[model samples]
Target chain A: MPAETTRAANRERLAARRAAEAAARAQAERRRRTVLGGVVAAVAVLVALVAVIVVQTHRTSTSANAAVPANTVDGTVISVGSADAPVTVDLYEDFQCPNCKAFEDASGRTVAQLVADGTVQAHYHGMAFLDTSANGRYSTRALNAAAVVVATAGPGAFQAFHDLLFANQPVEGGSGLTDAQLVQYATQAGAAGSSVEHDIRNLTYGDWVKTATDQASKDGVTATPTVFVDGHKLADLSSAGLTSAVTAAAAG
Target chain B: MRWNAATAGPWLGTAARLVLGGVFVVAGALKVPDPGAAVRAVRAYRLLPESLVAPVAFGLPVIEIAVGLALLLGVFVRTASIAAAVLLVVFLVGVGSAWARGLRIDCGCFGNGGEVTAGETAYPLEVLRDAALVVVALLLARWPASRLALGGRSVAGTTDRKEYSRAR
Candidate 1:
C-alpha cells in the first residue's frame, strides 16, 4: 500500500512539471509573436510618415520661389502660335534629351508650317529631369534660359531659342552649353536684353523648370518628345504621322 | 575554426543578410530621390489601377529601406526576412505581368525605370533575379540565426540553439 501511494505521488509531481513547462513555452511564443507584430507595425508607420514627407516637400519646393514666364497658361505651359487656332498641340520636351532633338528635327518644319498658317496653336512644356545627365545642371539651366527669353523677349524669341538649343544640344553626360553661349543664343533669337542676360546667367527660372518637370510627370508626360493633339496622345511621333493626326483632329 | 555546418551556418546567414540587405538599400535609395520617375515606372507596368499607382510608388521605396536596414543591422531577422520575401514575390509578379503583356518597360528594379525601346527589356533576367532573392529571403526566414545579429543572445553561439531546433 505504501509503495502504491509513493508511485501515485511521483506521477502527480511529473504531471505538474509538464504543465508548468507547457505554460512557459506558451508564454515565450506569445512574446515572440508580439515582437514580430511590433516590427511590422513600426515599419508601416515609418513608411507612411516618410512617404508623406517626401511627397509634401517635393510639392512645396517646386512651387517655392518659382518664376512664371509670360503667355504661360498652366504655370508649366508656354503658349505660342495663334490663340484661337483650330488645333492645339502640346509638345513635352527636355532640353538635354537627345530624343527630343531628334523628334524636333523630324517634325519641326511641319509644326512651324501649321503655326504659320494659323491652323495650330503650339504649347511647349520644357522639362529638366535630365539634370543628372548633364554635367552642370545643364538641363535646368537651358530650360531656365528659355523661360527667361520668353518672359522678357516674348514667345517669338522663345521659339527661336528653343530651336537653337535643340540644334546645338550637348551630348548626354557632358557639361551643357555655357551661360555665355546661352546669352548669345538668346541674342541671336532676338531675346537680347540686360534682364535676359542676367536671368540666363543666374538661372532665375530654375525653380520654374523644376516645377514644370514635376507637373509634366504629374500629367503623365515622363518621356521626352511626348506629343498630344487636342488632348489626344499621338502614338506615332513622325512628321507625317503628326500632320495626319493634326489634320484629323482639326477635321473632327 | 574548422569549416563545417556548425561553424558555417551563421556565417552563411550573415553573408546572405548583407548581400540581400545591401541590394534593398541601394535600390530604395536610388528611387527615393525621384518619385516622379518611380510613379512613371509603376504606370508603365499597367497592372495596378490608376488610383493605386501613386500610393504604391511613393510607399514601396520606404518599405524597402526599412526592411533593408533591419536585415543589415541583424535586428528582427526573422520578421524582416518575411517582409523581404513578400516584397520579392510582389516584384516577381510585377515583372512577370509586364513580360506577359508584351510591354516594353524596364523592371524599374533600381531607378529610372519606365518605357524602354523594344530591344531594351530584360524581363527574363529580372524575373530570375527576383526569384533568386525570394529564395534567399525565405531561407533567412527559416533560419534567422546569423553571426552579426543584435538580439539579446549571440546567434552564432549556443544561444540560438532553441531557435534552430524550433526551425527544424
Candidate 2:
C-alpha cells in the first residue's frame, strides 16, 4: 500500500479510539454523579433533621427556664398539720402517674384525715419525674401548679386542689390538661388570681419540681406515690397498709 | 453491587430495611411526642456527659426517624444502613453499660423507659436485639443494591473498567 493510504488508515483508527474514550469518560462521570448524589442528599437531609431537633429541644428548655422566676430558688417539701406532730408522714408522688392517682384515691383521704386530726405532720414531696411518661410536660405543669397553690393558699387549698387534680387526671400519651384547666382547678381550690394564674401558666415552680424530682431519685424513690412514715419506706404500698403503718409509727 | 444483586441483593436489603426501619420508626415516633422522657431515659443510662444528654436524647430520635424513613423509601440504602449500624452500636454500648453497672432500668428504645420498680430491666434481650440489628445493618450496607432502590445501580462496570485500565 502507498504511504498516503497508510496515513489515512492511521488517522481513522486514532479518531475511532478517541471517540470510544470520550464515551467511556462521559459514562463514568454519570455513574459517579448517580452514586454521589444519593449520599449528598442523605447527608443534607440528616443535617436538616438534626437542626430541627436542636431547635425544638432548645425551645422546650428555654421555655422551662423562662417559666421559673430567678428569685425563687427551689421547690419545697410542702407540709401540713402541726409542726410538733409526733410522726412525720412523707409522701413522694407525681401528678401524671396513674398509679399515684390510684394511691391517692385509695389512701389519700385517710392521710388527709390523719393530717386534719393533728396526729401527724404530712409532708408531700411532689416531683416531675414522670414528665416524659406523658405528652406536653404534664407532670411538670401539674406539679408546678400544685406548688403555687401550696405556696400561696396553704395546705388546706393544696389538699382540695390535689384531690381535684386526680379527679380530672388526663390520660397518658396526650397533651393532658392545658394551662387554662390548671388555672381553673386552682381557682376552685381558692388559690387562683392574675399573678397566680401567671405562675401556673409559666410553670413558676418548674425548676423546683425538677430539683425535687432529682432529689427523690437520689433519695432512692424510683416510682411514684412512695410513702415514708417516720423514715421507713412502706414496702406493702397498700391503702390499709399505709394507714396502719402511719398509725403504728405515730403510736411509737 | 452487581455481584450482590445476582444473589439476594435487593430482597435481603429490603427485608433488613423493613424490619430495622419499622422498629426504628416506631421507637423514634413514640419518643418524639415526649422529649422529657427521652432525656430521663438517657439520664437513666448514666452514660454520656451531662451536657450531652439532652442533645443526644433529642437528636437520636430524629436521626432514627430520618434513617428509618430513608430505608423504608429505599432511597440511599447504603447510607441509611450505615446509620442504622451506628445507631445499633451506640444502643449496644448503652445497654451493655447499664447491665455492667447493675442499673435496673429499661433500655428506652421505645417509650416508657428509665427507672422501674423491680424485675423490669431486660438488658440481655435488648443487647441481643441490637446485635441482630447491627448484623442486618452491616449486611445491607455491604450490599446496598436492593430491589426497588431509588438510585441503585451495579458497580461491576466501574470495577471492570479499572481492571481494563490497569491492563492497558
Candidate 3:
C-alpha cells in the first residue's frame, strides 16, 4: 500500500466518527427539549384548573352575602333598652356556640335587670362563625330569625325573643332549631304574627349574619361569647366579673 | 442527563411518594366540603393577603387533589415531583412562620382547623413532616423511579426498571 493512500484512509475514518458523535448529541438535545415542553404543559394545565375553581368559589361565596340589605341601628342591627343609656354593653355571640348559651343562662338575668332599671343598654352582635358545625348553617339561620324580631317588633319584644332562643338552645354540633321552631319561639315571646314570622321562615337576614360574622372576625372577635364594654373586651365573663367591669366603665 | 446516584435509592423515593401522595389526597378531600372552615383556618394563619384568603382557601384543595392524583399515577412524574417539592417547601415556610409568630391556628391540612381557643399546636411536628416530604420530592425529581407508573418514562429516558434499581 502507498503511504499517501494509508494516510487518506485514516483521515476518512476520523471524519466518519465525528459525524456519528454529532448526530447522537443532536438526538439527545431533541429528547431534552421534548421533556421540557411536556413538563411545562402539565404545570400550566394544573394552574388553569386551579384558577377555574377559584373563580367559581369566589363568585358563589361573594354573591351569597351581597343581596341582603344592611339594616343598621334603625332597621339593620338590634339594640335593647334606651339608645341614650349611660352605659352600653356589647355582647358578641354565635347561636350554635355552647359557651354563648352558658353566658346567657348565667348573666342574662343580670343584664335584663340592668336594662329594666335603664342603667345599661345592650347591643347584641349576632355572628354565624359556627356555620361549619351544622350541615345547614343553623347559626346563620338563628341569627337571621333574631333579626326578624328586631325588625318587626320593638326592643322590648326582641329581648323576650332573645331569652327564648337561649332557653331552648340546641346541643352543640347538632343541627340547630328549624325555621318552624324559630318562628314558634318568636310567637311565644309575643314578637310574631307579623313580618317577624315571615322573615324567620324565609331567612331574610341570612346574608346579614354572614356579613356580621366577617365584620367581627376583621375586628378580632374570633371566639364566641365575647363581652365588651366601651369597646374593651372583659376577660372574665362571669356575672360578677361583668357587673364590676360595667360599674367601673360607668364610673369612668 | 445522567443517572442520579448521588442521592439514589428509587425504592425510598417510591415509598415516600406514595405516602406523601396519600397524605395530600386525604387533606384536600377533608377541606373540600367545608370551605367556610377552610377560610377561617387561612384567616387564623394571618399569613396571606386579605384578598388572597378566599381564593387560597378554595383553590388549594383542588390543586392538592390534582397533584396527588398525578403523583399516585406516576404520570408526568418529574413535573409532579417538582410541584410536590415546591408545595412542600411553601407549606413548611407557612407553618414555620405561624409557629414563629405564636399564632394559635390549626394547620387546616386535615380539616376542622380554625381559631382554636385552647389546644396543643403541633407546629413542630407539622414542620418536620413537611421537611421530610420535601426530601422525598427532591429524591423523585432526581430519580423518579417507582412501580406501576403510567408514563413509564421520567427525566426523559429513565423509568422504574433495572436501570433505576441499579442507579444506586
Candidate 4:
C-alpha cells in the first residue's frame, strides 16, 4: 500500500512539473510576441516619420528653387521659328517621350503656321531623361548629335535634324542610335564635313546640354516638352491650352 | 500526426524579391533623371489633391529605392515584402482607375517620358501580377525564408517549427 501511494505521489509530482514548464513557456512566448510587436510598431513609425521629413525637404527645395528662369542658360541653340519673332516659346523635349512626339505631330503644323506668319518663335532644348533608360533609343544619341549639329550647322540644320529624329524614332527600349545613324541624320539636316562629326564625337556641346538640363531642373521643369510661353509657364499643354497660352504670352 | 510545412524551396521567394527589387530600382533610377516628368505623371493620376502632387512625386522614387534595397538585402523580409505588395496594389488600382476613365496618358511606372498606353486591358494584367506578388508575400510571411535575411534568421528558424505545427 505504501509503494502504491509513493507511485501516485511521483506521478503527481511529474504532472505538476510538466504543467509549470508549459506555463513558463507560454509566458515567455507571450513576452516575445509583445516585444516583437512593439519593435515593429516603432520601426514603422520611424519609417513614416522619415518619409514625411524627406518629402517636406524635397517640397521646400523645389519651391525655393522655383524662382529661376527657364531660358537664362546659354546652350547650343535649336530654333524652329524665326529668331526675331515677337513671341518666343521655349520647349524642353525628350526624343524618347511619345507625348512630345505627339505634341510635335499634332501641333507642328499650327506652330509652323504661326512661325511662318511671324506670330511666334519656338526654341527647343533637347533634354535626355528618356535616353538614360533602355526605352530611350533615339533620344540618347540623336538628341546629343542634334545639339552639336545645331551648334556647328546653324538653326536651319537644327530644325531639319529635329524633324528627322522625331520622324525616325526607333522601337522603344531598343538599341539606341548608332554613330552612323547620327551622321546620316545630321547630313540630312545639311551638316557636311568632318566638323559636325568631330563636334558630335567629341561631345563638344556636352557642357551646354548639361547646363540646359541643370537649368531646367533649377526651374522645376521635370518632364519633356515642358513649354514656357514667353516667361510664364503654361498650366497645361493640351492643343487648346497651348494655343491660349501662346496667345496670352503674345498679348502680354 | 507530423506537421508538414509548405515544401516549396527558397528559390521562388528569392526570385520574387530580386525581380520586384529590380523593377523598383529601374523605375526609381529613371525618375531621378527627370523629376519634372515624374511630377507630371503624378499629376496625371489626379488621385492626390493638387497640393500633394509635387511632394509625392519628388519623394516616391527615393522611397522606392529604399524599399528595393531592403528587399534585395533580405533584411526585414516580412515588413519589406508586405510594403512592396501594398505598393503594387495601390499602383494597380491607380492604373485601373486611369484606364477606366479613358485617359491616354502614360502609366509612368518607370519614369516620366516612358508612358505606356492607358488601355483598360493592361490594368487587369497589372493587378494580376500584383496579386501573384501578394501570394508570394503571404508565403514569405509564413515560411519567412529568413535564413538568408539580415534581421531574424535564428528567431525565424526557431519559431517556424512551432508556427508550422500550429498552422496545421
- Clash pairs for candidate 1: none
Q: Per-residue lDDT for A34-76 in model 1, tens only?
A: 6886777697768675766567346435555567887677788
For candidate 2, write residues B107-142 as lDDT tens digits: 888964375633356887898899999999999889
How close to the true structure is residue B112 of candidate 4, measured as C-alpha lDDT?
Answer: 61
Considering TM-score, which of the candidate structures 2 and 3 is the better prediction for this target? 3
Cα lDDT tens digits, model 4, B38-85, are 766777766787678766777777767766766677666677677777
Per-residue C-alpha lDDT of model 2 across residues A1-252, encoded as one tens digit per residue: 699999999999999999999999988997798678767876876787778677757644633343432212234577778888888988888787887788888888888888878888888877775554345788889988988887778777887998899989887667788889999999999897798898988877776776677566555555666789999988776778977898899778
Task: Kindly list the interface RMSD, in angstroms, of each predicted candidate in the order they appear.
Answer: 4.2, 3.9, 3.4, 7.3
What docking grade does candidate 1 earn?
Answer: incorrect
Q: lDDT by residue for model 1 over B30-124, one digit each (tens)? A: 88777766777887777788778767877788788878887898777888899999999989998888788776678888987374422357888
Once fitted onto the true fold, the runs of candidate 3 whose alpha carbons sit more than 4 angstroms away are A1-54, A57-71, A74-76, A117-119, A132-135, A194-197, B1-12, B29-38, B76-82, B92-104, B110-113, B117-143, B152-168
Query: Per-residue lDDT for B28 in model 2?
Result: 85
Best by lDDT: 1
Off by over 4 Å in 2: A1-54, A62-73, A81-90, A106-123, A127-141, A167-222, A227-235, A239-252, B1-9, B29-33, B73-76, B96-106, B111-132, B152-168
Instruction: Give the runs in model 1 whose Cα sits over 4 Å from its true position.
Output: A1-61, B1-9, B33-59, B93-108, B112-125, B152-168
Between prediction 1 and prediction 4, the one with superior TM-score is 1
Cα error, candidate 2, residue A157 (Å) = 2.3
For each candidate, C-alpha RMSD in Å? Answer: 5.4, 6.7, 5.7, 7.9
Q: Quick one: ranking by lDDT, best first?
A: 1, 2, 3, 4
Cα lDDT tens digits for candidate 3, A156-241: 76788888888888877787888888889888777767677777777787667666776665555556777888788888888998
lDDT minimum window of 10 residues, candidate 3 chain B: B152-161
